[model samples]
Target chain A: MATWLEGLIALVLIIGGVFLLIGSIGLVRLPDLYTRLHGPTKATTLGMAGLLLASSVVSSITQGSISVHEWLITLFLLITAPVSANMIAKTAMHHDLTPWKRTKGQELVDPASRQAPPSDHHSVKDGKLP
Target chain B: MLTWAVIIVAILICIALFLNLWRLVQGPSLQDRILALDTMYINSIALIILYGIHMGTGLYFEAALLIAMLGFVSTSALCKYLLRGDLIE
Candidate 1:
């Protein structure tokens, strides 16, 4: 019975590994900044979750008790992945980084044009666009 | 039977790693590279857990946690740099 359980845990780990690899590939192969961002943010999060789940399961089985640390890491990964992606995208916008244009799409509007109105946007509200 | 299953999973993970490596090397922009790095961080965590299983030691779990923490910090720093033009002002 114990051996059976170990096998199952190992299977989960393998599957999780596969997901991780796929996420990495997307990070490498996607074109354009925004498009590439989608790959790692979405796929990699799932991948990590799978691996963590497998680890937690195995640890629980081996130690005869629940393993919560792996779960915590998984939780952290899920929450941070998207948030980090957002931060990067927003920063790209702030720094005037250009997004890739695939098909002559409106000549790629200036990043400044997408700025929100300067009312509650800035914290100080010192008559400056924040 | 269980051993067979574990072996199969290991194979799959190896394939996935190859795919991710391709992305890491082929990324055309700096942001993509950063994304790849983030993915790599997650992968490493998973890899560490698997290594723990293989070695039958719980210590690798601690290493995985550390990797997770470092990954988050590094990615945050990179994102900040990407946004503000400097990691520290």
Candidate 2:
């Protein structure tokens, strides 16, 4: 039973590793910043979750006690990855970085207004308007 | 049997590392580099866990945790710098 359990855990780890590998590859191959972020945020989260599951299984089997460390890391990664990506995208917009647009063939759009600039967009009182 | 599995996972992690390395090498913009670094951070954490399994030591878990913590801080700092050209206002 222990051996079988180990095999199962190993399978999970391998699958997770493959997902990570694919995500990294997507990061490289994707054309634009927005498109690239899609790969790592989605794929790496799934990959990390799988690896953590494997770790939890191994820890439980070997030590005969449940290990919660991997679970915590997985939870943290899931919560943080999307927030970080969103922040980066927003920052890029705030700073006027170029975004890859599919229809326009890489035309540079104003970072603050990827569409139209708001007349009241910049407000000192609200502190919420950028 | 477990040993073999661990070795396989380690090899796969190495491949992932190489993929991220490629991004680091050829990324066109600063943000791309930051993204690559973030991905690399997570890859290292996974690698450390596999190493822990191989050596039968739990010490590496602490290292993994540290890397995860540092990774978030570093990425945030980079993002902040990219935004305002300063880490602190």
Query: What are the per-candidate TM-scores when only chain A is compared?
Result: 0.75, 0.77
Which regions of candidate 1 fall more than 4 Å away from where they truly are?
Answer: A2-7, A95-130, B1-22
- After superposition, which runs of candidate 2 have C-alpha atoms over 4 Å from their true positions? A103-130
Q: Which of the CAPRI classes, incorrect, acceptable, medium or high, describes model 2?
A: medium
- TM-score of chain B taken alone, every candidate: 0.85, 0.95
Question: Can you give the lDDT of residue A2 in candidate 1?
Answer: 75
Give the Cα lDDT of each candidate.
Answer: 0.68, 0.80
Against the true structure, what is model 2's DockQ? 0.70
Ten consecutive residues with minimal summed lDDT in candidate 1 chain A?
A103-112
Clashing pairs in 1: A21-B16, A24-B20, A25-B20, A28-B23
Error of model 1, residue A35, in angstroms: 2.0
Native A-B interface contacts kept, per candidate: 0.70, 0.58
TM-score of chain B of 2: 0.95
Worst 10 residues of 2 chain B by lDDT: B52-61
Q: Write the per-residue lDDT of candidate 2 for residues A1-130, one digit (tens) a residue.
A: 3767778887888889889888988998888777888878899889889988887777766787877878878888888898889777766566566666572423334525344444355553344445
In candidate 2, the residue pairs with backbone N, CA or C atoms under 3 Å apart (3 or more residues apart, or in different chains) clash, namely: none
